[model samples]
Target: MVFSWRKRKPRNGDKKVHNMELEIPRHFICPIALDLMKDPVTLSSGITYDRESIEKWLEDGNFTCPVTNQVLRSFDQIPNHSLRKMIQDWCVENRSHGIERIPTPRIPVSSAEVSEILFSITDSRRRLDRCGCLDSVHKIKKWGLESERNRRCVVANGAAGVIAAAFDAFAGDSFEKNAHAHLLEEMLCVMYWMFPLAQEAQIYLGSQASLRCMVWFLKSKDISVKQNSITVLKELLCCDQQYGEHLAAIDGVNRILFKFIKNPISPSITKASLMVIFHTVSSSNEKTKAEFVEMGLVSLLLESIIESEKSYCERALGVIDKLLETKQGREFATDNALSMPVLVKKILRISELATEYSVSAIWKLSKYEERVLMEALQVGAFQKLLLLIQVGCSDETKEKATELLKLLNPYRPGLECIDSLDFKDIKRSF
Candidate 1:
């Protein structure tokens, strides 16, 4: 593909300079990518492709070579350092043609490297060197933060066990110090990156001491630390059912969660708090749900339903509906000043899920308390229920709406009650 052109006379450095405009050779390109290889490597089939392309091919569950179509026995790729050097040299020679030199790829971290880090943390903890242990934990956290490959390497080599053990051991009086709080943050944050924990790690982290460490952080004055604590708790519990029940068994977990939800540090914290409650509030009997009902969860839920957007509101309403399954919840709702008003206000006004929960809560109230049937009439529930049917909703919701209308039909006001409805405190959650 060379173009015929004139050759000028040799300059003073002609012997030192053999540079000329050259076309790219076919072999210099990756066969799979059909482009120049930035990180060329040789596959088991003796064919070459860019490292990223081959990794993607193997990750997609393909076992055969893309070019040779041969079954692959090993997926390891040896770096084609020789060919990479040739391409780099060619780019340097053709610098005047806008070719940039590609930098060498980094060496991937391995499980062996992470095992050494785990040893340092274990040794530091054994020697009672809190400062040294903190430093080792910081190193592991930094590496995990660098890349997903580094995180996998760290977690695969048992970083979770050592870090969680150290964190649990710090539950003594020293846990009160501000300095130790920072150490706790570093330790817990690393646990977050290693999701889908190994069975052994899950068992160790599910211990009472480990659970206490995170619950303490949930009460930290720092908003970020509070958020991190809740986030880690959610992930740790969500990983296994036994872990969730253990945390729920803690005496003050719900109280702290409800308070956090009431005066949330941020919307994410509020949402996470709701999720923790959602995951933990049930215990196969009515007493557990009753405890939450008596603990002001119902009031907080009504507030969330009014202040939050679609998803959070729907979640809040769902928790409320769950709470109503108990006699205590129904009595509390009928007693609370804002329960019926707030629940009725959300009907036909928010998301379909939210509307469903709201209608269902009111229906439950009407079914047991009997007084809610009139409370519904006062808040313009009858008109909203009728309009809901007209606009259409889930068949279940429509049936409930129909029955609710039937309950209030004799008392249906002669005039529209839209003006009397109050949505005065609706706040933006997103």
Candidate 2:
């Protein structure tokens, strides 16, 4: 890796240099490149780095100082003139040792430049220039990745709306099959990078058309698009609870959600999709619950309960608890093969919250349906309930278990109650 810059004989009055090797000063080396820094800049974390190396790091979507592993409070990188001078001096001294002096690096784009890009993209009168503006938007997205300040600038300049418009434009009339699908994905990626977006901006971009476009993104073959689409929708849903109903009403929401459940692309995607469903159902009426039942959510929950990890199981159980508020949900749970066993298996096994949810589901079923009661008895639910009472459980869990036991006690074998019309009057005579 070493290169000879020059070869010269020893000069007069110079001490004989025994070491022929050239070694870079430790302070001059960039943490990223492990070479002499060309343009040294100090971050808010009190770490100094090469401007080009740090800029590239930020562009790659990293938000922390690489050397110290500290989350940077400010994205600004101030030029370290002292360090730069020292490095330059070291380079000059080593010139005879074949060391090359580093050149200055380019400065990053300014917020004003990003602002101009966003304005052009949003200004429709310049129709011919929109494409070029979108290209600028892509550049701004790159800049945003470099630092939080740039990210805030992107949002402040209405990048959210611009990205939404890009989504709608490139989605085309046929939408999913649009030729500009890559542009659509790029827009989504930018939006995700600018996450925790302003509420007003989220509301602005949460238009009906935008909702539909995001739903379409869920069905995309591209996994990144799908992840970003769900993430954006989840964030938008957080902006306003009313949007949950609007999202649920959108076509293919249920189908796509079910698809995510049936064939998960990743744990994160599955969790987000489930959250959307949970949010939608939370704002909905009985009809929505029935629709969820018709979409086979019950079966999906049962499968998820058995196969998924603790967190997924907890979420599935929570959603099932909501769905079981309706007759259809109760029927689905009572009839499914894995429903009872999985419910019984998870009780007292995963987490306190999970145990509470499982007990609640079983309590709902056993209270109304005799068949479910018998099924519960056969599956050792009664024993588990008694055990739940004896062992430590939450107050709510103990109350539910006690109620379930009371309901089942009457149905216990040889414990049938007789008509007692005259018993009050007969008293001791009986």
Candidate 3:
């Protein structure tokens, strides 16, 4: 059959279209596919070809442009100059309306399925020991498209595996001290995907299995896994109220968490530990609070306020605020000499950070102790409060600061020059 040739249409920005004829011998033509070019374009390397079929030809290596004979080593090496410019123009034109790309739905695979896929890849105790599976795991963890559904699935499966593995190891007496440690490390590497899982699992599994896993992981010498384990437990405790009761019942759980809160090497771990303490305190019954107080968690929290890290200080302050809401907690705060002064200072210091949560805690603490309100005024915390107002405080901070200001007015005589400053002066001073 004879083929008919037609001149190609000119592109929008085309200055000129060459009418050059092809002079190549018929035998030298690419015999694999000789279809006419669908979208012919020129590359930066002075090559002219169809973009669609060039990608496949690239794998054979050293494929020169049929017309220009310009050497091209890889598909990436051939720059689509006109296409790039067109994309730039399109982006600029659509900048006002904004391009809306459709989101892909995430498939939720269960833990059993993931385990099966992983086991199918390798029978080794280490999931990543297989050649191709490690890469796949890395991609799933790092590069998988994100959504609430996918996030939940990843977290659930990961947490289930981690909890199951740790429980099996501990219960079956199959804990290979060294090998198990490596497995834990591998699991932690994919922890971001597993966090949502642990959170959901906490709702159904309660605290026993998850808490056991956390304790074992925390005790491990590996700092990475220990950090991740603390993070996972903190997430679970924060998300599920059901975990609170069982979490406090675990032997040495409070003490272990206390150690991390007091002196964790990782800031993230310390923050997580402090969050766990807050959840533990808030969700615990009177007996659990008593047990926490007996374990010196209150004192540990107090000391954390003076910690060199700002996050520790913030978390410590949060725990103290939660504790103050309860009668036993208020008693715990008052009985401890260092608690009031340290908390007042943190309230004022943390006001600079000025988050709604931080300010709410400060407001709650101020309500508990008239002495703390008086102490705050004595330390010119009112000035900080005034500054917060002037610099545009959040609704919570403004409300709390205003209430604390009103409370401080009752103890105004004790405050230095409290009467001298008017509201206008206070506003101007900041």
In the range 1-430, model 3's lDDT, one tens digit per residue, is 1223333444566666445332322322223345323333455555555444564565456467655667755444343445444434543554333322222222334456656554533443233343344444554454235444444544444544543343333322334334344444454455544545543345433545446656777887888888877777677776775576677887788788878865667778878888887788778877766766666777767765665456666567667676666666666766676764465445434534524444565577677767777656665557656766777766767888888778877776746443343333432211
**Candidate 2 vs 3: which has more TM-score:** 2
Q: Note the Cα lDDT for every prediction shown.
A: 0.76, 0.75, 0.57
Top-lDDT candidate index: 1
Q: How far is 248's C-alpha from truth in model 3 (Å)? A: 1.8
| Tens-digit per-residue lDDT, 149-196, candidate 2 | 567666766677666665555454455555455566677788887667
Model 1, span 314-422: residue lDDT tens? 7788788888988999988889888877988888677788888899988888888666777788778886787777777899999998988888777656532544434
Candidate rank order under lDDT:
1, 2, 3
Local error of candidate 1 at residue 351 (angstroms) = 5.5
Q: Which one is best on TM-score?
A: 1
Off by over 4 Å in 1: 1-36, 82-103, 115-136, 153-166, 169-182, 240-255, 284-297, 325-332, 335-338, 341-356, 375-430
> Which stretches in model 2 have alpha-carbon errors above 4 Å?
1-39, 42-77, 85-110, 124-130, 145-158, 161-182, 377-402, 409-430
